[model samples]
Target chain A: MRDFRHDHSALALNTATLGHNVEGAGAGWSPERVIDACAERGIGGIVFWRRELAGRAAAIGDHARRSGVEVIGLCRTPFLVGPLAERDATAIADDFRRAIDLAAEVGAPVLTIVTGGVAAGTKGMGESLKIVAERVAQAVPWAREAGVKLALEPLHPVYGGNRSCLVTTREALDLCDGIDDEALGVAIDIYHVWWDGDLSRQISRAGRRILGFHLCDWLAETTDVLLDRGMMGDGVADIRAIRAAVEAAGYQSFCEVEIFSANTWWKRDPADVLDVMVERFRTVC
Target chain B: MRDFRHDHSALALNTATLGHNVEGAGAGWSPERVIDACAERGIGGIVFWRRELAGRAAAIGDHARRSGVEVIGLCRTPFLVGPLAERDATAIADDFRRAIDLAAEVGAPVLTIVTGGVAAGTKGMGESLKIVAERVAQAVPWAREAGVKLALEPLHPVYGGNRSCLVTTREALDLCDGIDDEALGVAIDIYHVWWDGDLSRQISRAGRRILGFHLCDWLAETTDVLLDRGMMGDGVADIRAIRAAVEAAGYQSFCEVEIFSANTWWKRDPADVLDVMVERFRTVC
Candidate 1:
């Protein structure tokens, strides 16, 4: 395992921790400002949401690289299976390829995909997953052509109903294998998978297919399913242990910190949040 | 599978849907009133929370039986492995045995247990589950002697951290096999497990060890994790499909309707809720 104590070159900020606290009327921080702030703190990388990119993907990528921070990856593509996703396969494929194009333009090595909820007119996960797999398979060649990896992020099961049907690391890996492309892999998020009893075994199964590693704590008394994510060390998650398992699985890459704390951390100053993330990275995670 | 469209004699009500509306100032319904209401609806069985019994277990059982309503189960024991649960093995055993004795006194053949959250100081579920297994094993003999089966109710993963470390049906079955006792089994609640991709296979694996089957729906836009559960046909869960799997697995028993809807059903008249439950069970489930 690589030491993150004093050397945080492996650290990455996922911009979402700031949430509405960034770039809104009350808060004025452009993409360049966020990148510069991260670099000033010795943060090695930054991942941006598509909404913030706003068609300036290449410019933002260049600015981050020049600022001594890598654009680790893009936040996500549109939902591939839910009501928010495209209605037909052709439209879905077109939407996915567009996201892949953005990832390529941004010079991001990976494109994260939060698969949407249960498919319409479907009974259970079997058909929904089939639709996801088929749609993902269709997008693979374009992803490879752009030199970007498709990272399927299996979200927490709570989100399985409307956000993403993909809800397990093992399930994500199976989808990757079905596609049979080197461009396909998984992004392991601690928040989504920490409670899984067979996490270590599944992490072992992930091995080199891991495209990204995400950090966040699962607050034991999580009030809101979508927004009550805890910052590191503030919750009951076994952070160091899960990190060890991820490291042992050979995923010693950009460890991005992504917390969607609407009621708590998002209300704090961005600088303070980053400082605490770094401190917790050294001691707790 | 057993032609539930016209006949709901297998239906059971787990009184939590009534929440505080069942008893309190302004609510005059007693335990006997609830039992009589269920029997009047042709509901074959009913499960009661421990607080409502009030040391009159035998009396309540007799009252329900005379009204032709079976006392299917007690809602739960105190959390088996949480902060609220007894910390020491002896204390935990004493508490579990007492609950088992109560189940016997109420003539309930099964006791549903909502295993509490991760063990107090434990880091992931490994140590917590071990503690749960040990504590449960210690009480199994007592449970067997009382003719009550200890049904480990693996709650939704949403409740894993602080409500129940036992999350997945597969994991619960593994624990049951490890304890290796006839009295040890699982209660499959649709609200907790409908999102599982491997539900059917796990249901098949459960086979004869399915001590109970609880009904409710997973509303797609679920606002509250514990409350806000839907009626059978109102949510995204494939109720008929899941029932097919459970029935195929040999769980042709009293299917309990256990909805903890603080925002919806709990606010309505208990009679109306039971009427809707019977209607949904006949049409959807």
Candidate 2:
């Protein structure tokens, strides 16, 4: 395993971890401030959410690059095909194309895909997954044109019903197989997949198709499924082992810290949260 | 699939659905009352928790049988191994034996095993699962002697850390394969596995080794991961499809209704809860 105790450059900040996803949640740090703070800490990269980027993708991308930080990726496109997705299929396709364009404009190598939860009136995940595959297939041309990859992030099963039907790395890979687009891959997040018994095998199968890797902890007693993610060392996940597996599978990218602790870390100073993330990245993760 | 609408004879009430698991949660209906209520409604069977038995397993079992209601199964044995398991291995083994004796005394054919959460100081689920398999292997002799089958229930992956390390039906079957004992099998619960993409395949693989089948719904916007389980039909799970798969796999056992709805069902009258369960079991499941 690569040693992280003395090196901090591989650490990346997923903007949502600083409370960018939820309205009125964290320290409300601006994208510029977040970038400067990460750069000040010797952090190597930042993944921005669409909501935070507003119309500033190009400027933010340039700012991060100037600050010696890579634009790791984007948070997500709106649900491709689920309850939250645009009702019209064309709207969904247009929204996805715009996201790919944004990824290209921002110089983000990957655009994370959190395929929305069960489609309205759908009885099970099978139908919704099929819809997701169809939509991703349609968007492949745009993604390839933009020179950006679409990283399907399978949320935890807890989010299967209403958040994202894509709930496992294997399922994500299966979707990738059907699409068969070089621009499509997976973003493996420990919080959503640490419990998976076949995680190691799936990671190995993913290999170079692993576009991004996320870091966070699963609290022993998670009070809230969506917002109560623990900081790396504060929970029971075997971070080092999972990272070793990812690295062994040829993933040599930023280890993005993507916590959503509403009550704890999010309540602290943004600088403090960044400092702690860097510390844990070196010591725990 | 069997028509639940006209015939609830295949329906089994798991006591926890009435708030038996949490203290001061459900209407304080006694076991005798629960049995009589099920029989009156033409409900087929009832599954009791160990706590409710309170040394009266024999009498309750006899009464239920006399009332034409089967004692389908037992709620659980204390976790065989994990963070919540007893530190002394012998104690875990002894507790399991006692649980088996209770299941036999109650005339229940199967004892549900919720193999516990992550083991203390364990970094990953692999080590904890091995411990669970070893412990279950040790208790197989006692289970066989008591004429009771141990049904390993794999909880949702959300509970992998503090509730159960066994988080997939596939993983549960793997444990059964390791033990290779006729006394061991799996309990397939919809709430724990509706999101599994390989659900149908795993059910087919389980075949006759499926000792029990549990029913419940997964609410689209789940508020609580542990206690906010939905009643059948109230959530988005394809209960009938899953039931079809289980029945196709040669599982002729009762469809056990086991919801842990702290905010909704538990607050209702016990009779009202039972009535709703029957209504939904017929219409939704």
Candidate 3:
């Protein structure tokens, strides 16, 4: 595994870490400011949420590239299943294609897919997953055409109800294999998959299909399920070991710092947050 | 698949549903009172938390038997791993044996094991699980001698850090196979496993080694990770389908209702809670 002890050449900032994703959360840092901050800190890449890219995808992507920071990925597309999923079939398909388009316009190499909650009126995940498989299959042609890879992010089981139905790396990979599309892959988020005892085997199975690797910690006593995430070194996750597994599985990309620490990090200065993120990336993660 | 609508002869109450497990939570009901309530309602079994069994294990067991309700299970053994686990090796082993003795004295058919949080100085579950395997192997003699079955209950991954290191049914079965003891088996709780896509396959693999089948629902908008469990028919779990899988696996035992609803069910009258449990078992579940 590559050593991250001295430099942050492999580090990236997910905009959520700065509170750009949630409303009334962050310091309202503009995309330009976030990009400049990354460049100033020697961060190699940046990821943006859809909320920040309203109609300026191309401009933001170009700005990041001009600043020598690659826009490695986009935050995510709208959820495709569950209660939060678009109600109409056509709307779901259209919204997905639009997300692919956004990824392309933003020049993001990958577009993350958070398979939303179980579909309305569904009991367990079977029918919802089937629906997710079908929709992703439908969007494959557009993703293939746009040259934007779709990385399915399987969330923690806690989010199985209202957020995303995909809850394990194995399930995500299985969905990817069923689709058999070059454009469809998986984003391994430590917060979601850290507790998975079978993680090492699944990472080995993921190999080249592991398109993205996210970093965060699982607090021992997590107060909130949705927002209370920990900074990398502050919690119990075996960050170095998981990263070793990811790197061993051929994921030689940015180790994106994607924390949703609403009460703690979000309340701090963005500069402080970035500085600590860089330090933690080098020493801890 | 038995017709639960006709009667609750297969139903059991895991006393946590009555808030007896946590301190200062329950209605201050005595073991005799709870046992009598179950017998009066035709509930065939009762599972008691270790808290309520302080020094009255044998007496409570005798009282339940006299009331024609089998003492089906004991709530849990002390966490054998993680932070809450006893620090001294000899102490953990002694405590485990003591729990087994308590199970024998209580005459409960099985003692559920909620493997506690990750061990000190350990990073993921690897080392902690190894410790769990070794300790459980060491205790097989006592468990077998006492004729007290130990049922490993894999909690939700959310509880992986503080409550349990064991987080998947597959992982639990794998541990059981490693021990390879007839006295060891798994207890399936629906609250922790309703999101798993591979559940049906794991249940098929569990077969007769499945010693217990727990009932509950996963609320759609669950606010708490430890508490806030939903009652049957009140949440979104496919309770009947999971029970079908468990039953098909030759687990002809009590469908134990084990809920930990902090704000909702515990605040209601115990009689009302019992009535709702019966109505839900007859209709939705």
Q: List model 1 lDDT by residue over A1-285, tens digit each.
A: 778778888999998987744445215678898898899999999998888888899999999999999998987888889766777777777878888999889889999999999877665567888888988888889999999999999998888778888998888988988888899999989899988877789889989998999999988888998888988887778888888888999887989999988778877777888888889888878
lDDT-best of 1 and 3: 3
DockQ of 1: 0.69
Model 3: residues with Cα > 4 Å off, grouped in runs = A22-24, B22-25
Per-chain TM-score (chain B), model 2: 0.98
Question: Per-residue lDDT of A90-188 in model 2, one digit per residue for the tens?
Answer: 888888889899999899989999899888887889999999998888888888989999999999999988889999999999999888879999999
iRMS of candidate 1, one decimal? Answer: 1.2
TM-score, predicted candidate 2 vs. hidden true structure:
0.97
Candidate 2 chain A: worst 10 consecutive residues by lDDT?
A20-29
Ranking by DockQ: 2, 3, 1
Can you write out model 3's per-residue Cα lDDT over A206-249, one digit (the tens) per residue? 99999999999988778887888999877788999999999999
lDDT of 3 by residue, B1-285 (tens): 788889888889888898886556658888899899988899998999877889999999999999999998987788888877778889988888888899899999798888888888778888888988988889888899999999999999998888898999999999999989899999999999999888898999999999999999998888887789998877778888999999899988888998888788888888888888888888887
Write candidate 2's Cα lDDT for B73-180 as tens digits.
997888866667788988888888889999999999999999999888877798999989888888899899989999999999999888899999999999999999
Runs of candidate 1 with Cα error greater than 4 angstroms are A20-26, A86-91, B20-27, B86-90
- Give all candidates' CA lDDT scores: 0.86, 0.90, 0.89
TM-score of each: 0.96, 0.97, 0.97
State residue A116's C-alpha deviation in candidate 1, in Å: 0.9
Return the candidate ranking by lDDT, descending.
2, 3, 1
